[model samples]
Target: MLYGSTYPRDIFAELNRLQRELEQSFDIEPSIRGIGRGGFPALNVGSTPQSVELYAFAPGLDPAKIEVNLERGVLTIAGERTDQPGTPAQQATVHLNERFHGRFKRVVSLPDDVDPDGVSAVYQNGVLHISVRRQQAAQPRRIDVH
Candidate 1:
């Protein structure tokens, strides 16, 4: 008589092998917050009763290079980091390089009550501060019965 393999043995072995491979290759992608070209800078956002504030720590950039736009209850900040601070030779010896340099854009969703018309931004001391006033219609009002 001819010798042959059993039914359950081959199937079980194959399934086990596949499980092992999947477990070995299992990896999770890192979650990125905010928007940017490569490495995004940290942003601090705060909201008050009458306005919303946003601060971004962006050094080596000018006020002209940055552009702010608000549309459809969304705020977008886009700018390019030009390498004009140091000489080419000086930049070659950077030890701990943590600064981000490139074209970057960050978009934030504004609240329905925010007034897009009264948005403003200012850059100072390597920080960009933005203030958005809330619309009058969105403010809570007390009503009295006549």
Candidate 2:
């Protein structure tokens, strides 16, 4: 390793960190169907002229177990993913374990245009979908050419 040289891995890590920070700080992702704040149960956000929608993926859990809350313009999704039936015995050897089971949380800062009072959440097929209407002032309108 050269004294003044930087490794490629270091550069990639730094870039990823900066991108994550931008996404969190601005509450905007590269795309609506893109990965969100690094955490369990990733989400995708999309916006239309009338409202903004959020989709959170959390499979294999009952809807009743998931908690959704909005406070001070921030949306929070929290819950736990527990081991299911036919669980492996304690003495069983595990070759690969990719599932995440336990408590998880994700706080998404809502855009200023969203109306907190108009927010609604619905969980179906292991996905929690939420929608918040845009304020009248924030909606885009076409103006007549004068």
* Candidate lDDT (C-alpha), each: 0.69, 0.71
Q: lDDT tens digits, residues 6-81, model 1?
A: 4444554455334433433463211223343222445788999889999988887878989899999988787767
Off by over 4 Å in 1: 1-39, 85-96, 138-146
State the lDDT at 38 in candidate 2.
44
TM-score of each: 0.63, 0.66
How many collisions per candidate? 0, 0
**C-alpha displacement of 121 in model 2, angstroms?**
1.1
Q: If candidate 2 were superposed on the true structure by all CA atoms, what would the RMSD be?
A: 10.6
Output the TM-score of candidate 1. 0.63
Candidate 1 — worst ten consecutive residues by lDDT sum? 28-37
Candidate 2 local lDDT, 26-92, one digit each (tens): 7553332223444567788889978989999888877888888888888888776777766652446
Error of 2 at 115 (Å): 1.0
What does each candidate score in C-alpha RMSD? 16.1, 10.6
Of the candidates shown, which would achieve the greatest lDDT relative to the real structure? 2
